[model samples]
Target: MSDFSATGYQPVSVSDPEVAALVGQDLPEDAFREIRDILFTVKGFDLDSYKDRCIKRRIAARIRQLGFPHISGYVACLAAEPTEQLALLEALTIHVSQFFRNPTTFMVLEKKILPALLRTRPAGRELRLWSAGCAMGEEPYSLALLCDELCNSPEQITIYATDISNDILKKARQGRYEPHRVAEVPDSVLKRYFTLEEGFYRLNDRLRKRVRFFHNDILNDRPFHRVDLILCRNMLIYFSPPQQEHILKTFAAALVAGGYLVLGRSETMISETRELFECVNAAERIYRKKADDVKEDD
Candidate 1:
């Protein structure tokens, strides 16, 4: 029901049952193979093991609005042109992000975790953090603000924020925000960190320079550098269980021994991989990597 249409795309109609029926139709095994090819060619997302039903539901909603009822037609649309593929990929890859999305979790980071990380860091060392799936850059900027408040020189901290969407990454690097996006940001921090211009907020140079933005696919690529904390946030919810497990193992590999992993409020480690990470702040979904674990992929 949320307005999800992003640049040059129409919003999919959300009359529940109609959307359900279109998705409920039986899809051939070959249908997914075709889908994986189109997705990879167009958006570079490999959807081979991605849960078909969940994808079909999203596809059906888009198809219904576009007046196509059959999955074949949807595939045709994807094959017809590159633009359609871009639009479909934008819709398929979920981009629901907000400033300081989980306040309690952020509070724990600001009040406790960061201070502890700073204390144990070797002399004159800088902290490195990665905001995986950092859609539109709010989370990394928020971390920059926190680092500014916590560290004597915020420039000492470095945050790498990445997302698969080239479109979102462009917007993120611009560092501009709609006014409403800052609703949860504290007034003191807001005024200190951003300058208002033309009905939007622009992140100041200090905070902006501390964060670097890049394109990363968690499932396919190596994480950047050793990190003190990695904030993957809400992205795990959309992936299939096996995909989730694959990514978590990558996350564990990316972190230094005893480094932190943060997830969205609704996500948890798959039961099978519990031994790889131990919870630190259970309610905030904060975890620390197991010192004894080694990557099988390595």
Candidate 2:
């Protein structure tokens, strides 16, 4: 498995051989299935779509955190506590975000993507952008800052940010962040867009009003339509190949012809969806949706 250290997930070691065996063996298959089924039944979270080992590690981490001896105990806890189910969902859906998390990608968006989209936008039509899996609103807020700079008028742009976690969405709506979260924000831009209050940098009302936050599951919910650009960064790496492909196809259908799609620095268009989009910036993982006349891979 790839190192999840970046997300603060550390491999746990225990002295108890049985507990160690549970972690080492990725938990018994039946126990893991029970956990998955419980999450699906209670929260509508489809654990089957996630990478198996990654989900296992998260579950094991939770088990270790709660001081559970084994997987069965954790399963019982999940069944009994509603809060624990939300906690497990939060654990499973790891969200690590900051303003302009990847500088180059944002630079590309500000300098190249936004300009091109503005020039090509049809008269009387709003420029629509979606930030899928927008954790705590940084990605979409970052886009809003750029759009605020480039667009002729505020009405020209419409930004929609969505995440599966309602709790995270509530935080996003609050539009407040700690100092570390806004570290990447440029000094001048920070002064203009945010107010430092009580040690928290709060995004100003004008910019806050620019974005619409929704509780959405990309796998199961309807995607935004007629979008000029979609930024789904760092979130796709959690899913299985088939789920990833399903999401890519959904993005393809969501975007208008010649629309742009920006993925994470680590993610790429899978083989099945490659023909749906032409690579625009390989280093930045930016792609453009192919026009309807273009032929798709069989």
Candidate 3:
């Protein structure tokens, strides 16, 4: 008998009794204090403000998978182990994303938001868009498709896609996807927008050139320039409240007057900071910056 409970169970080696017993334990007080300092030295982001329980579960998952004896050993491994550092980042970073992720949101943008913007775009000026924290390329690519549809010449629109993970950015830049991933794109649009290549569809160069991919930490990097719209979805859910507030303020500053902001369906602007934005589509999580704001925080 394996002595394992199947309904709520895992293998002994992968879930060693001692390690399972340690699940509820906090990272050693000193180790918790040191983690951010160490991670910042290597990864350039502070982890201290992340909710302890969230951090604990992620670290515990890693420890369990690797059969580490203690959080201290994991901390030491993070310092001395490059592979472990990458694994830690995988655990901490948000990777979940999809194309035309929420159909109604895209529907609203196409039906109302973009048409309104096109009506107002200054003559001879390009429409600029930024997809901050763009993951695996889906969201930004979807935006690119929208721009291509709306533009007189797709070349006139510029989309900047930025993410903290180099690995994910590389995948995004490739713009190749399994057929199932393109299911949301209507057949007509999919054929016109992408080309079949080696069992996958690749975003054509016209669309690819419209998007410029960059490795950027939204909290640390300079804001994208001449931004008419910014799409920063889902990525902020893991951030501390203060970080969220700072990012919203930063986004408000970055946006050109009347420029739109799109957040994940689950997110909302901090009401106390209402002076910076006016919700344009409350149900859709879209907002427009006040006319008075243009320059970003230094």
The candidate that wins on lDDT is: 2
- For residue 279, what is the lDDT in candidate 2? 96
1 against 2, candidate with superior TM-score: 2
TM per prediction: 0.79, 0.82, 0.81
Please report the candidate that would top TM-score against the real structure.
2
lDDT of candidates 1 onward, in order = 0.79, 0.86, 0.78
Candidate 1 accuracy as TM-score? 0.79
lDDT of 3 by residue, 38-132 (tens): 87787655676554466756656666566555566667878998777766877778767777988889998888887787778898788888999
lDDT of 1 by residue, 1-298 (tens): 5433543344345354443466464344565578778877655466654534577657656665566645676778778878877777777787667788888889999999899999998888888899999998999988888888888976668899999788999999988999778888889888888899999999888678888998887767777756889999988876767778888888887888888999988789995668899999889999998886845233
The regions of model 1 sitting more than 4 angstroms off are 1-73, 77-86, 295-298
Look at candidate 1 and tell me the lDDT of residue 281: 86
Residue 69's C-alpha lDDT in candidate 3? 59
Q: Which candidate model has the greater TM-score, 2 or 3? A: 2
- lDDT value, residue 250 of candidate 3: 81
In the predicted model 2, the residue pairs found to clash are none
Identify the runs in model 3 with alpha carbons over 4 angstroms from their true place.
Answer: 1-57, 64-69, 79-87, 196-199, 293-298
Model 1 clashing residue pairs (backbone): none
Candidate 2: residue 55 Cα off by (Å): 5.2
